[model samples]
Target: MSDTSLLSSLLNLITTATCNLQSELKGAGLPEPWIDNASLHPWDEETPSKKYWDARRTLISALGMMTAVVQNPREKIICDDLGYHHSAALNFIVNTHMADVLAAPNVDERIGLPVSEIARRTGTHPAKTERVLRFLCMYHTFQETSPGVFANNKVSECLKKGHPTAELPLMWADVGFRSATAFSATLRDPQTAHSMRIEDAPFGAVFGNHTSKSTSESESIPKSEPGTASPVRATIFEFLSRPESEVYRSAFAKTMVTLDIMNGALGYHDLPWDRWDKEGAVFVEAGASTGHLSNDVLSVVKHAKFINQDLPEVCLQGEKFFAENNAEAIRSGRVKFQPNDFFTEQPVKGAAIYILSNILHDWPDNEALKILKHIGDAMIPTSRLLVMEIVIVPSLSQSRSPPSAPVDQNPNDAPWPLPKDYGIVNRYPHHQSMEMINTFNGLDRTLDEYVALFQQSELELVEVHRIRKLVSIMEVKKKA
Candidate 1:
């Protein structure tokens, strides 16, 4: 295809997708979400129908491609260089509570808060605050109603103090920013590049392990098996548990809550909960921090009991959370907290279902194998292990049309002009795949990779249920 023809094809795709999305919204009697509005669109407040979701995904995918194709190559490369600057500016805005100041009840949305006032409230320099707001304004985050004055727009409102997505920016900036900046260095360094050890990840490269004990002193800690990269120091999880890292630990916990809200609770909807609904059914969630997933599950599987297992400290926190938020479940003995390490033997044998949500991706194949083996050892013939994770579909594929989704299937195929798996619309898994590498020297895997890993652990992948666009329930059982 000629360059001009390809460009036209892209434009046509964008137009068609946009029209479809708009028509769906209008048909549903919903207002189209606008970037400039401070209030969330009605659709944002609730889940949309499947048709609406498909249309919206199509539009977003096409638009993302159109953006890349239209921008000059040189300009795109230059702009990409300042990705770090964008992160830094956003970090500054969030850390200084700029969004909170602008969204305060007394603050006028039209007039906006002056940079001086915002700076005073946040204890920052006025001139510096203005520059950060202006930079963010260019990206349609905060809006500048007048020179040196800013207010929360739809994009910025999510970062307000108590908003659902407020901790996302904080988490990404504090946990990921430096690691991302040091990506090249970590990969280029011979010591870390080929290493599969979690301790050798970009986080460790940027900020060497903070734990005081040496590797020799910490023999009780889990070590990589032969052929796996050995730990040079403590991993991020261990560091987060230290008494001195209390502030970061608190922030990390809140960040995870925001992460859950962003990921939604629908990922568990498609699983075969009915089959296990008999009385005395047990669901054990490994590495379950604060038991949020299990709590959500309690609402769905009324007859099943849930046990949330995690580190001792996190188990304590989960107990408090259950007491305050799900007292009835705890009081009724339907939900319980167990402090246990997944690396050790499986304590609760023959649970009806076991869940390892977003846990395996935090370790490499070798370490992940150990985790799987432990879980597999405890599984009976009827016991099922649901590995809730992203099963990465390639962004580019041979299919030129959306793959057919049978009543029982959730195909991720994309149409022509938009790469398969909906291109940038499906970047969450890819971004998270890199995040795993950056933070833990781990990675997200394709279905084939998972199948191979499960086989090695003496488990079989019996079924797959794509629950959300970015998450799937890989149902496995003990090998026959």
Candidate 2:
């Protein structure tokens, strides 16, 4: 092979290595001290500068391999080991209604549901369930306190759907929407006329549309006209929307309520209300799909107002979750709920804080801006936007410009921003997140892009904090 071809071959090896590591981390178990940082505000997960640098190095090496595949397209494997684990994890949860079964507290070990008994309750082929249980043992999502017996742990508790502590955000992103959309979508068809002008990826077909603008206006956002059929992470209608019946909807709703109650009990431990409170507080869960995040927000904030928003079609669950819960709470009087389609509407005045925790990074800038502009419009002078996100930092080893000017300077004076040379792009968690969100045309973001998004909205970056090892806290204020 030619030297260039040979170099590409070496890079391929690197990509495979990186993907394996990513999967290992996910299966390794959820981060420790998780209960402590559940409501991750800024400054929740602090570490030494050296640790950040070490992690940045590992991230760059991983992402660099993945990005190379984007351009070269040939020398790589799509489903690294992590992809397999993700599927395994989802199947594991679904079979036992793992989330529900786990929520029953000590009932399992208390009843001594050894592998045979667990199989009996779930009504599974006992031998097969035993095989799966052995897999769970390896991951320790459930603990085998004694041989043959299983019970919940911090990680297992989170598996319950609708549990606020549940990273339903993560789970829903994977099996929830992608699986459903893939039914009729052409996820890997890179040969359409639109690939040249990528705006053409069929909305229904869009799988991995992750993108970043030229760090400078000189580096323009690739042009693509808006199209119908936007991607959603997942909505509450899995039960209703699929079969198109009220019974399914009702069942899904009940599941959601059960989830909510479990999450509240498991999640109340790390509510981050004290350390970071702002003046104009509004968190527009733009793709609030069914109001799960809004429910989470309501838990932390009695004073902090929320903008629970999503597509009009998907808005019912927000109402349902609140209405069902509040009916009981009203006699008790606890939380309030509001619904809006954030893209079309969000309150934009005198706001202290606005949040898009698991938003952004979903679209190529082509669509993300419309949502950001709405968020910007809602900002008051003192308001700040708090995003609990996975920000990609640039790789430290890559050579770059000296620090004399800002890393994002423009050569052509074209109007837009670009990624900075900060070496953090790979810090994002869940290697498969890009592939999973592909079902929705949703992409991930780098720290540089977040800065640019804020700039477009005339917002300023006041502070940036890291949550756990994978998530980040970006605090921003409307620019003066």
User: lDDT winner among the candidates?
Assistant: 1
Q: How close is candidate 2 to the true structure, as a TM-score?
A: 0.53
Candidate 2 local distance difference test against the native? 0.48
- Candidate number of the best TM-score: 1
Tell me the tens digit of each residue's lDDT in model 1 across 1-480.
223455676778778877887888989988888877887776665446556667778888878887887889999999988778887787677667787888788988867898899989998999988888899999999888988888888888777876647665655666676567567777877767898888888777654544433221232322222223444555688777788666566566666655664635654655669987778889999998888888766767978899999988888888897888889989999989998999999899999999998899899999999999999999999999999887787666434433344443335566665776888887777888888888888989999999999999999998988654367889999999
TM accuracy, model 1: 0.88
Residue 419, model 1, lDDT: 78
Q: Judge candidate 2 at residue 243 and give its lDDT.
A: 40
Which regions of candidate 1 fall more than 4 Å away from where they truly are? 2-4, 23-29, 209-232, 397-411
Candidate 2 lDDT over residue span 1-480, tens digit each: 222343354355445545544454455443323322213211122222333333334445545544653654433355342445544554456535654664455564333357676777777776776666656657656666567666655556555665543444333433343343442344444343233122333333322232321121123332322342445322222223554344334434444434333313323223365444454444444555556645644555655555555555556666665676554432333323445655675754555556675666545575667777887787777666777666654433321322245555443121111123322233234442444243344556777878887788777788876432345678877788
lDDT of each: 0.77, 0.48
TM-score for each predicted model, relative to the true structure = 0.88, 0.53
Off by over 4 Å in 2: 1-86, 89-93, 98-111, 114-121, 142-188, 192-304, 311-316, 319-336, 345-348, 394-428, 435-437, 467-470
